[model samples]
Every structure is written in structure tokens, then in C-alpha cells.
Target: MPSTRRRPPRQRHPELERDFVRTPALGYEDVDGSGLVRCLAHGFPSPLVRWHFHDEYELHLITHTSGRAFVGDWIGPFEPGHLVLCGPRLPHNWISFDVPEAGAPERDLVILFNHDPIARAAEQIPEMREVLQLLDRARHGIEFFDMAEAARMHWEAVRGARGMRRFAAFCDLLCDLSECTDYRLLSAVQMQGVQAEAQVDQINEVVNRIMARVNEPLSLAGVAAELGMSESRFSRFFRRATGNSFTEFVSRVRINSACHLLMQTDCFIADICFQVGFSNLANFNRRFLEIKGMTPSEFRRQAESRFGAG
Candidate 1:
């Protein structure tokens, strides 16, 4: 497989790049009407499909086609009924491999909204506070399973309504997403709720250390000793807070870092293996394939499509 030798463009404005004649009706005016939410729809093979980020929380649904999905540091497959919520500035893109020569007429349904309005309101509205955790999880990107049909209905309702009705529909969607349990957090590391502030601080420090010195050996026993805890206690504490065993979390961090290098640099895969702290070529390849579902070279070749056709 070929590798990308440079970085992809980081931002794109589809509305300005293409005429709306081919896309589904857009709800851009709703941003002005409701002063918060904006809905968008686009077809496959359109300029809208690119690696990019913006300052809005986006709920994206795929109504047709199956292909690869790139969200922050996560790479995976997505098919019809795929739904994901990406937080502000989290880079993402979807490339449909099943598109016909004529291209798909309507493949994506999206809703974009700002964070400040709802966050500020939650400060005063007790009921509105429930969605805050959901929003926080969006920072890492959230893929909701079994939510496609309901998500489609909600998107249509919000798209067709105006004024308070539009806001109400949007809120109703957020409520269901907040209560959703069939979802996975994609990108970086997964963090569960930590009850104590001190514990949060401790875990944060440990994560920062791991990220900073990823090339170094970090053992659970060593970390436990540093924290003045026994091996089993530290293991339980770390797992409870991060949803991964200490060793697994370290491996994930290394793999995530390797993904970035594969996308941005032309370094040899063997060199990258050791650069990310893996002891040997065979182990690195195994771990990367296990986590990303592709070999390092295969990922690089596929990732180049994220920039879209120039």
C-alpha cells in the first residue's frame, strides 16, 4: 500500500464550494431563526466529504452507503444507519466505498449547534443538566448504536420546524442521546466517572505522564508504587476510572500516537514501531491491526482519502 507524505487540509466549507442544486434542502436559515441549531444534508461524492473541523457540536447520520469513518484519533467502519456526535473542533470525515458511478443523491443528514447556549442554560435549568455528560463524551466522539431510525425522525422534525418548535425538537433529541447506553466512545482514551476530585487529579496526572513519555516503559507496579498503593488496588482504581486495564490503556495510547505518525510522516513502519515504544516489528503490527482493523501501511493509504479529491 502507498503512504501519504503530507497532511490533509484541516477545514472545508461545503456551502461555499458547491451549488445547492445537487444537495438536499439545507436548514442553514434555522441557525438564524432559532439562534442555536443548523441542519444540513448532502450527497455522497460531494465536496462536503472531507477531513475537517469546526466550532459546533455535530450530530451526523448516514442514511446510505457503507465505508470508513475517521473521527479524531479513531478509525472504523460505518454503514447505513450509522450515527455519531462530534464535539467542537474534533476532526472527522466519511468516505463511502459503495458509491455508484453516478454518486449517491442523499447520503448524509447532519445537525450542528453551538455549546455555549445549552451549557449556560444548564447552569440554571436542573433538567437541562442531564445532557452535560453526553456533551462531555462527545469531546472524544460518540457513535450511537441502534439509534438510526429515531435519529432520522428527530432530524426531520427539527429540519421542518421553526422558532420554539425547532428548539424543542432539538432538545428532545438531546435528551434521548443523553439517556442512550448503547454507544461507544471513540478516539484517544475512554474515561469513566471518577467520584472524587483527588482521584480525578491523580488519574489525570498519570494519563499526562503516559502521553508525555510514551516511548518509555511504564509498568502498573511502578505506577502503583509511585502512588503509594498496592498493585491490585492501583489496578482496580485505574480500570474504574479509565475503563481499560493499565497495560491496555498504555497500548492504546501508543497505537493512537502511531496513527498520527502514519498519517503525517513518511517514516518507515518499523522505525515508527519502536518510536511508539513497541519492542519489535511483529508486536507493533499485531497491536495496530487489532485496534485499527488495518495494517499501518493500509491505514496510511486509506487516510489520504480524508483530504478528498483536490
Candidate 2:
């Protein structure tokens, strides 16, 4: 007998293409009556995914396919069973690159929940502080390298349960993730002032400037003028807020951009240097070596060996 079940229609949401501004917050509804947590499993050919953020902590499992995973300012490879925990308002997306003859199957197992309820629970119960601490680490986003199957089982349990049973399963999943020691932080550094709107705006302004005009020379004085602050005040404020000085932050961002170019293009080393904001090849080489521990040519070689060129 042929199966007659029809798949649900795909849902679409706004996504950030290159702009790192605030991603749209997707509101989840309790259509089936599970209010505190929302679990969803879906498939797509080439899903309408994008770099986005929300106020909910997301435990995302890549159940199928492979591609690049973008979280915060990090971009790396991902495959099936890739499990990551994203803290509230952390920008993230997973883009699949597989092209199967049968089309890509269901790819994501996602669970989203708010931290306030958990925080309230933790305050009432002393032991739940560990979970709160886990949430803090999630601010940088966490990619679990071990216990993939266990996390999947917990996700399934939560997806299948209802009422208090669902909540209990969710709690168990968080406990398991919190206890797991084999994980890596995805972002090079976590974004600061997640809850402070003005601080986040300043960071975004700087980030947007760097990413958009990576080829142009960046100066603290110019940035300060653009933001209407004195250079000294801006320097102090940016360092305190983001844990990186203005110049250091710009160079880091430029280097990261150069890394992507190295892996994705066949451009000449010196041209790549000028294209990523360095004034001269020597300075570019020096900065790249200091930050990446390799010269531009060497970095390109490694990237080619790892990803097999664009």
C-alpha cells in the first residue's frame, strides 16, 4: 500500500545576507499545546535559510546533509549529526551543499526555548545553576563533537512527548549537553552587550564598516568621527565593550575575511593582501602571520589542501 501522508508546507522567514544587523525574531506558536518549548523537524531541497538571530536559545541538530555552519562570526563545515547550541540573539545559519539524486531529505531537528523560565527555575532550585552556567557558555555557541546519538535521542524524546513529559525531556536534553565535555566554541569571540541595545548598535556599526569595506584602510579616528565620538573615548568604549581594541578588532575582521578569500578564490597572495585592508604586502604578511601563524601563501596552501580549491 502506498503512503498517503502529505508533508507540511515549507515556511519562510527573513534572513541576513551580508548585513549583520538584527535578524528577525521568529515567533513560535503552540499550535499543539507545548508552550514553553518548540520542536520542529523539516526538510527542503535548498531551504530558505539565512544568518538570523532570535531571543530563544536554539539547540539545532543537523539530521541530514552537509554544508557550512555560520554562527556569530564563525564559518565552518558541518555534516549530519552536527549538533550546536546557540544562545539567545546569537546569529546563525546552516547552508547545505549536498545534491542528492533523490533531493535533500529532512535536514534539521530544532528545539527552541526561552532562558527566563530556566533562570527562574534555577534560582528556585540550587542545583540548576550548572544549567545556567551552560547557558552562559552557549553565548559563544557550542558545537558538540561527541555524544551525537545521545543528543538526537533526547531531541526525539522531546519532539514526541507532550505536557510535562515534553518539558522533562527538554530538561534532560539540556542536562546532557551541559555535562558533555567534548565541544568547541564556534565564534572566535562572543558578542558583548547582548542585552544592551546601544552597545550592540555600536558593535554593529563597526562590524558593518569592517565587513563592507574590508578592502579600504580602517582608522580609529575615522571610525570615531563617523560615530560622533572622540578617538580616545571611542577607543576606551570599544575595548571595554568588545574585549578588543579598535585597530585589533579591524585587523582580526580583515584577517578572517582574507581567510575566506584564500579558501574560496585563486587570487594572488599580494592582491589578496591589498584586498583585505592592509596597506602593503609586508604589513599584510606580518599581520597574517601574527594572527593566523602563517604567511598568506602558506595559509592559501593549507586552505587548498583542506577544501580542494574553489
Candidate 3:
């Protein structure tokens, strides 16, 4: 049986902190170097486990333990073989529950690479363009399922090889991720292109306000009037810019905040409901079920597994 001891508490970092900034380890000269691709392995209690974002894309794989994963506005469970691709500047973190007091020596295998080089190379290399779509989807944080063994094998190939061989192995891994269909987009909303810069600014202001004041009441009519547009027009503009209706986007934001509290604190569900701006408990439960496919209590119960045995 797995140990039921609770793991030590980790220091919570601010949501927007741009942590883990460093130059990529260029492996072109060394026989065992990773070149443009930076490969990293670390344990659960290590400094690498934090809520932060970076300028490069990250391919993350779980090799041990179960825990809650926070990716952008998405929150869910992760176990061995779980894999995700996070685009540049998209914040993410994984907290393992099953770690022992001494800690597991290895919990994650990661690959970090930048998009500029690839995008530039694709301008001349048509074959490399296949990964462009994969990178775009990664902007919303892509979670791939049922490919753990293959991912580990590919990571090993890249880790052991160097120079052209290493690059080839990395490309092979990207090709597989690109073709994979058994995956889900983690973020609740995606930002599509808008018509004008002013429109983008207006919408961004509204979005910033919504996120900043998630606990406050937000009505489309009020926001539309503030933006000097009719409710109908604002609805169209909001949906186009955010891929979700105004109300739906607000609900997702609140629910996302509630999820963070659920995983990180022992607050009662009813208390959390009000804390996140829901006026009633039933409405909060319904919305949580609708979005997370679980009741708040059940979500917390499952989240406890991240600490190991329940």
C-alpha cells in the first residue's frame, strides 16, 4: 500500500511571477548535449515545482506520483504518464501528493524550446512546418493522453544522443505530439484574432478588469455601456475576442479561482462559493459540475490524492 502521510507544504508563489528564467543549454558542441532543446529532470520538492511561466515552450511528462496540475486557467489531476505542452509565457505547475518525507528523486522529465527559431526555420523548410499547428494549440496548453511510454522513450533518445541525432530525436517527438488526437485543450478560453487595435485594447481592458475583480458583480449591459456599445454588439465582440460568451467567461474565471482555493486551502465549499463571488451555494455547485465535471467536495477529495495515500 502507498503511504498515507501528508506531504510537506510548498511555498506558494504569486500567480504572475516570471520565474525559471535562464538561457537554454546549447548542446551543439558536446556529444551528449541537447543543443537547442533543453532537457531537465527533477524531483517533487525541487525548486522547479512552482507556478510560473517562461519565454520558451515546455514539453512536460510525469514519471512518478499523482497530483493536481495548474495550467493557465485549467486545473485537473495528473499521474504517471501524464504529458503537457505549454506555449511560451503560459503559466503552469504540478504538485505531487504521494511524495515521501525524503522525497522521490525523479518526478518530471521536461523539454524546453523556443518558437522563434522554429518559426523562422519553417519559412524555408516546408517539412518543419508540420509542427506549427501543434505549437499554436499549445498556446492553450495541450494535454496528451495515453502516450507515456512513447514519450519516455523519445525523451531517452534525445537525452542520450547529441548534435544532429539529438535534433532528429526531438523532431520525431514533436511529430508524434503533432499527430496525436487523444488530447484536450486545458485552458477554458482561447484568444482569437480581433478586427482592430482599439477593439483589442477595449477588450483587453474589460478582460483585465474581469480577472482583477473576479469577486465583483459583472453585467454585460454595464460593461457594454462603459464601452459605449449596445449589449448585443458587446456580446459579439467579447465572444470573438475570447471564444466564450461574456457570462460564460466570467463563470469560468470564477470557477478557476475557486479551483485554486479548493486545491490550496481547507476552506469550506460554501465559504469558497461566496469568496469567489457566487451568491449561492447551489449555483456554485452546478457551475462547478458543469465546468469541472465534479462537485466541489469531490474535486477536493480527489485533489487530496496529490499528497499520496488518502
RMSD of each: 4.9, 11.9, 7.7
On residues 1-310, what C-alpha lDDT tens digit does candidate 3 reach at each position? 9999766544333344342333233111232354688787777677656667788899999999987887875768889999999998887889888888899888989888889989999999999999998998899899999999999999899888888898999999999999999998997555666779998898889989888988989899998999889999999989988889999999998998888787777777888899889998999999999998889998777654443334
Model 2 per-residue lDDT at 198: 83
Q: On residues 1-310, what C-alpha lDDT tens digit does candidate 1 reach at each position? A: 8886665434332222222322334324323464577788888887667787787899999999999898887778899999999998888899898898999988999988889999999999999999999999999999999999999999999988988998899999999999999999988777888999999999999899899989898999998999899999999999999999999999999999998888767777888899999998999999999998889998878777666641
Better of 1 and 2 by TM-score: 1
Give one clash count per candidate, in the order shown: 0, 0, 6
TM-score of each: 0.86, 0.59, 0.66
Model 3: CA > 4 A from native: 1-32, 40-56, 62-81, 87-109, 114-140, 145-157, 168-172, 175-182, 193-199, 307-309
Evaluated at residue 18, the lDDT of candidate 2 is 30
Better candidate number, 1 or 3, judged by lDDT: 1
Stretches > 4 Å off in candidate 2: 1-30, 46-48, 190-310
- The segments of candidate 1 whose C-alpha lies over 4 angstroms from its true place after superposition are 1-27
TM-score of 2: 0.59
Compute the lDDT for candidate 2. 0.74
Candidate 3, number of clashes: 6
What's the residue-level lDDT of 145 in candidate 1?
98
lDDT of 2 by residue, 108-221 (tens): 778888899889988888877779768988987999987778888997898788989988898798788889989987754444544478877877877787789988877899
